[model samples]
Target: MSEVRSEEEKAAEARRGPRRGPGPGGHAMGSGEKASDFRGTIKRLVGLLRPERALVTIAIVLGTISVVLGAVGPKVLGWATDWIFAGIIGKQLPAGVSKDQLVASLRAQGDNQKADLLSGIGHLVPGQGINFTEVGRICLLVLALYAVASLLSWLMSYLLTGSINRVIYGLRRDVEHKLGRLPLSYFDRQPRGELLSRVTNDIDNVAQSLQQTLSQLLTAALTVVAMLIMMVTVSPLLSLIAVLTIPVSIAITAVIGKRSQALFKEQWKSTGELNAIVEETFTGHELVKVFGRRAETEAEFARKNDQLVEAGFGAQFISGLIMPMMGLVGNLNYVLVCVVGGLRVTGGSMSLGDVQAFIQYSRQFTQPISQVASMANLLQSGAASAERVFEVLDAGEQVPDPATPGRLGGRTEGRVAFEDVSFSYSPDKPLIEGLDLVVEPGHTVAIVGPTGAGKTTLVNLLMRFYEIDAGRITLDGVDIRDLTRHELRDQVGMVLQDTWLFNGTIRDNIAYGRPGASEEDIRQAATSAYVDRFVHSLPDGYDTVVDGDGGSLSAGEKQLLTIARAFLSEPSLLILDEATSSVDTRTELLIQKAMTDLRTDRTSFVIAHRLSTIRDADTIVVMEDGRIVEQGSHDQLVDAGGAYARLYRAQFAGAAVDIEAQDGMASVS
Candidate 1:
């Protein structure tokens, strides 16, 4: 009798579904440890730019020159302001000690010829108001200097753009190459979405930060240093006041940046988590719909999205305070310098022009300090991204291909042996320990067992997808590990239950097994697998495009295509992993007929859940708890009434009941 679900139970299921939280794909990303070696990460990131040293150096030189020119422009403008004041005031130069000081200040501004020329002219034009001719030349010189600085700034930007592009291009390429070398085990522990985010999103963030910060780094440093010296040269009193803000601003930035840096890392991780949820949710859309889980799925998405929003807000808000705080400190210092400089000018300790230049230098000094403070966030984010990329590059690779790889020459006899082989997915728990198995050439070995009986592990070891912890698996008496993976796997064909077909025509997917196969060869293989039954009915026949993993085809039709692929490969050893378990009766019969035809001279290992399918197998190896408990022909196993007999009888009774139900439904209809 069926038990009825309560209203509350039904509502609970409607609200929560089977999975109310993140699925298997949304595992927390990263090692969750802070980056201890920030300097090392920076050094390694800079090392990637080593190839473009010459271009980067040119950019640095140009940037430094532009910053120096910009810094000096304000001082020159101050001199101009003083000259304008003097010209308007009908210069009967403020005499005595002030006269000596004014001349000395002019000479100290540099360009002795220009200063001496202006000083001699000023005496000649005393009480005559101003030297218009000399003023125009000074103004034009200042304008030309600024023009050259502007030109160099543009050129620097151009050079840095080229250099950054080349460096980032190589970085992306290295990341891609690293993915190929990473071991399958590395992928097992990490979510696919997180790895993808590192490759696409993290590296992109690094590139953008470098583009903005790398070009300005030299300019900011040079500006700060030059401005500091100029400030001290103008008047050490004001210089001291302006310099006081540097340490204070740095302290504030450090505190705020430290808080935001952690938030940025979390933001990136939350982004990956969100992406994982989307990937897993959409990939299993069919399953979600079948179980009426749309509401629960949306709830899960909302939870992940909210996490992303919170992380983003924290990171941006904390980092956002840096520029404003630094600006406030700088503005306060500016007002202090103004008051002190004005008082010194009135007391005649500093000339009007010198006081003006000191004010300009004070402003210049604080600009770079603010820029550096703000750059703290950029540098930290870039460093975090670099560390992520480097982690992938540093991950352990598959045991390097054999130094001296062995080969499987000509046609192999398919003699596979697992001699006392011990293996485990992890060291803490062992799956198969000291197991022994041997299959002679041209034999059909059916592996029958309950789920989790290490049925797939045996094939995984045989194919060397995983290395055995102890003992050795041999193909034709040669250790499979001795041969290159390509050389060993080339002769083995697999047809798993999940058919993998790209978005291409049927011919292309079938020909994937043999890239060099001819049209005739494909047709012959398709005919052998009975794939032509459906292909010929299509409008475009073999050319019909398969989209969304062959969504248009039935499960049985996809299986036939995979079988055709295997047939075309003409492999000596075939591993059929539950290949026909999910098909209907007619499709199963067709697949069985195709398998009988294809297994004539080839060695095959068939993994099956239904006992009746393996009745004709040459030998049945029944497994229980990762150990083989019974081995014999079907009749022998039934006669013995062991694990295999019990499994066979249960499947038989189930099949009979299913047939009875189908007949009753047909009668009622």
Candidate 2:
């Protein structure tokens, strides 16, 4: 019963949307994680960008150009400053005196320091005012360079956005396809919510990370290089001082990032586990309430939520330290450059304008390094998500369909035969071994057994839901493995204990059994399955819309709708697995009659626990421990007093004895 309920919940969860809630620390869930194989995952992520290499290359070139232009702006402005200062000094000198005469006069007065300062001001006339015209030209040139750089940067961003979108689009498509190819066993082993996180949350994170960091990384790197070149041109000594901070920043980032990477990985893993719990709780809320486990559920949620918070806080705190540490190093480097540059300028080895320009270059040099260091967390988070997504993409898929798929000609005879079929969920724990059964065309076979007796497993084998470990199952003498799965399933229709209905009108739900089925055909199937009796009483009748959870409908009504769907399909083989188990007595009788009509010429496999329901079946196969212990007509089995007879007596005779005892006690009272 638990397994049955689990299967039902899985079906319902698959149809529903993911349940979302604020994660720990009031942030959205799945903020980020770290990859175990950081370098390998990063390499694979870069491989995804290969298709967009051309656009990426073009964007990089534009970004480089923009950075170069922006980097040179400070140097150009510095030249204008030198010009104005030279003019101011030259204007203070005698109107006709040359710079050489001015210096000679200073030295003759025994002012060697002043004479040296005067000599350092190159191209300064002794009797000239500030060159406002040249200064204006330089300002305009700086403006033009900035404007062009901004334009190119915008273009580069546009190209990168397009390229990134295309790459992510392909990635999502691939993941979707990979999901379709994966075996059912993979899904069985994984939680739906965890798998969903990989598909939705993790993939979205990867896209966002790439979008946020790719262009900025490129720009920051190029800016760093460009600023370094400008700084070197202005003053190599100060440039070298700025360069020293790089090693320190790298060391800090490396240490903190390594620790934070593990935490981020834990944070996302906890997010997935929490999501699975929430999904399970939400889907089974009614069951939880019935069992009065709401408090336990809440406690479990709190524990996992707390785990997520701890992991998130540790990861965030460690990664957050990088920016500030990098900033401190940058500030120290800036102070050193200032002191050195000032000394050089005062000693007449460097001009005031050159010192100012080098200071600006030094700031620019440190800024990109800081930006890159801060982005380490984002990169690690994205790499972790990419690895999770890659795991799904790398999972082994189901056995491929036959290269030359065998087809069942227009219609199938529905003669299913299992020949020495052996299978198991685990290598050592065999569930079905050497199981052999043959269902003749147009015959109804009832399979009855205790729970875990392989009743459903037998049907699953016939449907090829799972492959057999040895031997083969055949349909009309053709091996099932030789035919495509689609072809094999086309002839089968199933109505499980749990009914699955999408959010659609009754008419549409019925038509889903046979897509493109006409309205008259849908109504005919509904009438045959007893759905018409209640549906017509409703305001919308066949047009009444039902939700995915079978809105406002009784359990029996939901069961009937599923039977009507199977009836509409008119499949060659029908599987009724406890189809009437959930219905009341009257409803069950009605369903039984409908099923009897539906099964008229179709081969049917009925798995039931109710001895009364399968009493009239052509053959009753009693199974235990994955093997059929008894197979014969119902009456024959009863007369033989075997497993079937014992089961029948337990259901009917036991009830009779209990009723008689109650009557005797009432009479005595």
Query: Considering every candidate listed, which one attains the maximal lDDT?
Result: 2
Output the worst ten-in-a-row residue range by lDDT, candidate 2: 1-10
lDDT of 2 by residue, 1-669 (tens): 012222322332333333333222111234233338888988999899898899999999999999999998999888888898889888888888888898899889999887878787765898898889989999999999999999999999999999989999999999999987887556665776677878888888899989999889999999998998898888888888999998899899999999998887887778887887787777677887888888887887898899989988998899999999999998999899999987787666888788888988888889989998899888888888888889889989988999999888967898989999998766766767898899899999999877767788777777766689998999888899999988888888889887889999999988889999988899999999999999988779988999988888888989889999999999998888899988976566667778889888888988887754687688889888779999989889989998988888877566545544654665576
Instruction: Assess the local accuracy of residue 615 in candidate 1 as a C-alpha lDDT between 0 and 100.
Output: 71
Write the residue-wise lDDT of candidate 1 on 297-326 in tens digits.
Answer: 788779878988998898888888999999
Q: Candidate 2, overall lDDT?
A: 0.83
Residue clash pairs of candidate 1: none
**Per-residue lDDT of 193 in model 2:** 66
Q: Report, for all candidates in order, the number of backbone clashes.
A: 0, 0
The estimated TM-scores of all candidates read 0.86, 0.90
In angstroms, the error of model 1 at 374 is: 2.6
